[model samples]
Target: MFKSRKNGVNRFAAATATHRQRIQVEHNSVLDSEYPFRLNFYNKPPAMDITIEEFELFALDRLQVLKVVEMAKIRNRSDEDYKKDIQHALDTYLPMKS
Candidate 1:
């Protein structure tokens, strides 16, 4: 409950100034081993510039791909069949290569 001389500010709060200071950080400084999904941590969402339409498309595409994988598993397909089915779904929805 200490007081400042000049403006009568809380001296106790000033004494704990370091605790109130925001931490200076560089992006991606945290180690991957310490944080799985380093880019997608709960505190840090990915920075993306996309239209709402594009975002919905990406979300729907991922859902479709996941659904395919789940269906293949429920069918109890052979390992090769499962792999091929998932691969085909990924190719259609989340294509990485031409």
Candidate 2:
């Protein structure tokens, strides 16, 4: 067991912080290997395969997010509320980590 300081923090935890960060960077690299970039301006087709159900679900979710933005614009919402609504729609429908 690692010796703990008065604050109950372990020295080993601090010592391994860099190791954890390195592991996280490697994990992110692996995850991004699938479709790293947000856009494909060159018209490149996606290489990954998805089930039919997954494809439909993704399509519907994207449509919902677009509709939310459309409705927000039609309603002429305030700037703050507009951003909040858009964020809510994206988080609820088509969330992707940056």
Candidate 3:
């Protein structure tokens, strides 16, 4: 697989096909509309059935986004630049759906 580069920085990595079987597993999940979004304070444990691979990806994305913010802070980037960097990270790693 070819990696995407920007400013001579390697941005993309090859992904192993490990999630296919996990995602195809039969599982019953509860989709409570009470928590349609993740930004709110949690009232209880979330009710969802996600594969291990998906969970791992979610965690990694969260860490990546946080890393971008922390790095921007350490670099003392301007507010607009910081926001842009965060937005780019979010858009690339996690997309919001309505």
| Number of the top TM-score candidate | 1
**Candidate 1, superposed: residue stretches over 4 Å from native:** 1-48
lDDT of each: 0.84, 0.82, 0.78
lDDT leaderboard ranking: 1, 2, 3
Question: Per-residue lDDT for 1-98 in model 2, tens only?
Answer: 98657887677988888577432334445335545664545445567989999999999999999999999999999999999999999999987977
- Measured with C-alpha atoms, the lDDT of residue 81 in candidate 1 is 100
- Evaluated at residue 42, the lDDT of candidate 3 is 74
Report the poorest 10 consecutive residues by lDDT, candidate 1: 29-38
Pairs of residues at least 3 apart in sequence or in different chains that clash in candidate 3: none
TM-score of 2: 0.50
Off by over 4 Å in 3: 1-48
Badly placed stretches (over 4 Å) of model 2 are 1-48
Candidate 3 lDDT, 1-98, residue by residue in tens: 99766577333432344333454534324334565553657766567889999999999999999999999999999999999999999998888855
Is candidate 2 or 3 superior in lDDT?
2
- CA lDDT, candidate 1, residue 69: 93
Q: Give candidate 3's error at residue 61 in angstroms.
A: 0.8
Reference-based TM-score of each model? 0.52, 0.50, 0.51
Question: Could you give candidate 1's per-residue lDDT for residues 21-77 as a string of tens digits?
Answer: 687866665555445554644555446678999999999999999999999999999
In model 2, which residue pairs have backbone atoms overlapping below 3 Å?
none
